[model samples]
Each structure stands twice: as structure tokens, then as C-alpha cells.
Target: MRINMKPEEAKDILSDMRDQHLCFLESSENKDEWKKKYLKEAWACDSGAKALEKQIPCKPEEYVPDFPYNIFSTQKCAKCGTPVIGKKISKYCSECGQKIDWGEE
Candidate 1:
């Protein structure tokens, strides 16, 4: 699929991506507050990324899941049985460093 957008459009997307990536990378010294703040910032960045995509004027060939899909609902680590927090694409257990099987990709 080839789509030629205006240079300004491309620059907008690049700028958005860079900003979001920076937000994701920023960290705090406080562990508890860091996690909470990180998740909030990540969600904001994700929303911004989606908005940027929507402005691209192209049709998506696949689905994009909504952010914060039931924070209470979680998947268990296949090896250690510890609940996998946050991301569904997590391939490693943060607690035990064991490989996680999240079923079919």
C-alpha cells in the first residue's frame, strides 16, 4: 500500500512519534509514583499516537485494542503463575524472568 501524504503530514507523524517515545522513556526516582505516572503518560501517548494515525487518511488492515482494558483483569505467567501486569505482549515475567506464553499472536 503506497500513500503519499504531504510533507507536513509526514513531519507531524514523526514529531508525534518522537514525543510519545520520549514520554515512554522518561522515568522517576519514586517506584510507586513512577509506575502510576508511567502508565498514565503511556496511555496519553497511545491516545496521541492513535489520533495521529487517524489523521493519516489511510485504512487500517487490522484491529487496535483499547488502552487500559480492565486493569483488574490480568493474565498469569505460564511458568511461575504470577499475574502478568500491564501489557499483553509481555514475553517475560518481571518477577521470575521466566518466559510467558500469552497464547497465539
Candidate 2:
């Protein structure tokens, strides 16, 4: 079924569900094979949701760290202050699911 909701809201809901499933898996003593399988499937769905959450495009802002050397420069998400690491930042921010635009060097 189709659901109408903002990307942030949907991501929060999915994150909550994933956290709940993790709590269940950790706290429950039920070693039942069926339940374990079910949780595994839910985990897979959550993984997919993570990719889907990167719907908001945001450009990364370059910054220089306090380190003595300027080589310590890096980029952070403009929307969320999450650091983006790598020779080239990925298409989306891993922390807040903001689509990243590295722009032209």
C-alpha cells in the first residue's frame, strides 16, 4: 500500500522499527527458528529502507579542521553536520540520508 509521508518521517519510522526489532532479538530468549527467520527478513527490509531514505539532496560544505595542517580538510553535510569521508563523497550522507552533491572541483 502507498503511504504519503515526508522522507524524514518515514526514515524515523523505519529506524524505530529496526531498533525495536533489535531490542526483541537481544532481549528475547526465544530461539525459535521461525522467529529468527522473521527478524532476519525484517532486517533486510530495514536495509532497503536506509537507501530509500536518501531522498533529500544536500551539497557538502568543505571545511578545514583545527589540525595544524591544512591537509586535514573535509566535507560535511550542509543540512546535517555529519562528516562525509572518502576521496570522493558518496551520493548520499550516511547519517541523515541527505543526497550529496560534491559539485565541480
Query: lDDT at 49 for candidate 2?
Result: 70
| TM-score (all chains, Cα) for each model | 0.31, 0.49
RMSD to the true structure for each prediction, in A, is 16.6, 6.7
Identify the candidate with maximal TM-score.
2
Best by lDDT: 2
For model 2, give the 10-residue run with minimal summed lDDT. 64-73
Global local distance difference test of model 1: 0.54
Itemize residue pairs with steric clashes in candidate 1.
none
lDDT by residue (tens digit), candidate 2, 42-61: 69759867766667555788
Q: What's the residue-level lDDT of 102 in candidate 2?
A: 67
- Alpha carbon lDDT of residue 77, candidate 1? 53
Q: How does residue 103 of candidate 1 score in lDDT? A: 44
TM-score of 2: 0.49
Error of 1 at 34 (Å): 1.5
Residue 60, candidate 2: how far off, in angstroms? 4.0
